[model samples]
Target: MSSAHYDCTLSLTDFCSKETERVCKLICLITSTGTEMLSPTGFVVLSVALGFIMTFGFVNNFVVLLLFCKFKTLRTPVNMLLLNISISDMLVCVFGTTLSFASSIKGRWLLGRIGCSWYGFVNSCFGIVSLISLVILSYDRYSTLTVCNNNRWPDYRKPLVAVCCSWVYSLIWTVPPLLGWSSYDLEGAGTSCSVSWKVRTAQSHAYIICLFIFCLVHYAASDICM
Candidate 1:
């Protein structure tokens, strides 16, 4: 390329990059400074409710996990499904709910853009994982009850594989927002961040519709399997 052409191209590229950065900063400012949606008493109530969910979820899931670890007899494939569910739920309680709870208590997002994104991603992924786990467990039980011979015990590897697939499936929905198909932003509550379902843009709409369809199809398939 000619020297003048090369210089012009580099300058254009640099300008675009700076403009993108500026827009991103503006967006972060608006989202992180979302107006509070709760009164003092309401905020207190929300905090208490969030605390309950986190504490109860953690305790129950941790106990189940501990039992599975402590008892060999409880480590069967069916119980393994429970263990997977517990682990996912525990993650939601910690990585997902706790961040939202903290943000809600503070009346705004203290963690900035990265925190909101991470919070949304972890919450979405783990929530989907837990749902898939439940479906798998239900299917396992249904198969046990409906199978003809019912003598062959399911192997542990099968459940492990199912769990792995569940995580991957969850990622298919959660990761796209991070990649710019849509985005995570503070919800109406002003503290919790999640998929920007309210955005009216084409990409945001498409992502929401696709995610809804995926969930519906998977639920139907799980039901049929069960």
Candidate 2:
């Protein structure tokens, strides 16, 4: 190649390298600063909201539990389902909402990958248990109006079985992500974590679809029909 042309080509190469390095450094800076995704004011707002939810939820559910424990009349079969719902809600506030509230206060997730996984799994499990308990409560109310007394199961046994089944059903859906059907990651302003809903892989897609249909739609439809 001619000398002039070689020099021009070398200049172009150097320019490209510098530009690439600058871009990479910019990306690194953005990623390193967690507050870039959410303004400090926004984080404060989230923290306030989550803190309110955690406090009110914990106190309200705790009251219900206390009442249930203190009173014999409140221990009826129908009330058992309500107790189960209260238990799950209290746990979610403790294990799930509290972590998110703390992260929101700092404007970032502090628990790393393992904490994110725990937050996702624990929240999902307890949230679903609460949802299923509501559905069961609805069914119990409906059955009381429509079904004969002879068709109903024994009082305490039925609610006890349902409470157990709600936990099991929640486990069935939430455990798959831990086993690699999908995974958990930070989401929504980087302060909270849950199932990686943005993943487009076939496995992740399938799990999300099944989770939506079985855990969400099925329960909602059943409740509506009942």
Best by lDDT: 2
Error of 2 at 113 (Å): 0.3
Count of clashes, each model: 0, 0
Candidate with best TM-score: 2
Pairs with steric clashes in candidate 1: none
Compared with the true structure, model 1 gives a TM-score of 0.80
- Badly placed stretches (over 4 Å) of model 2 are 1-36, 150-154
Writing each residue's lDDT as its tens digit, candidate 1 over 1-226 gives 3222222223344434765665444444544444436677787888889989999999999999888888888988888778888999999998988987897788666788899899889988988888888888888888778877545775788899999999999998999999999998887567788888778899999999888788657666766766
* lDDT score, candidate 1: 0.80
Worst 10 residues of 2 by lDDT: 1-10
Whole-structure CA lDDT of model 2: 0.86
TM-score of each: 0.80, 0.84
Error of 1 at 80 (Å): 1.2
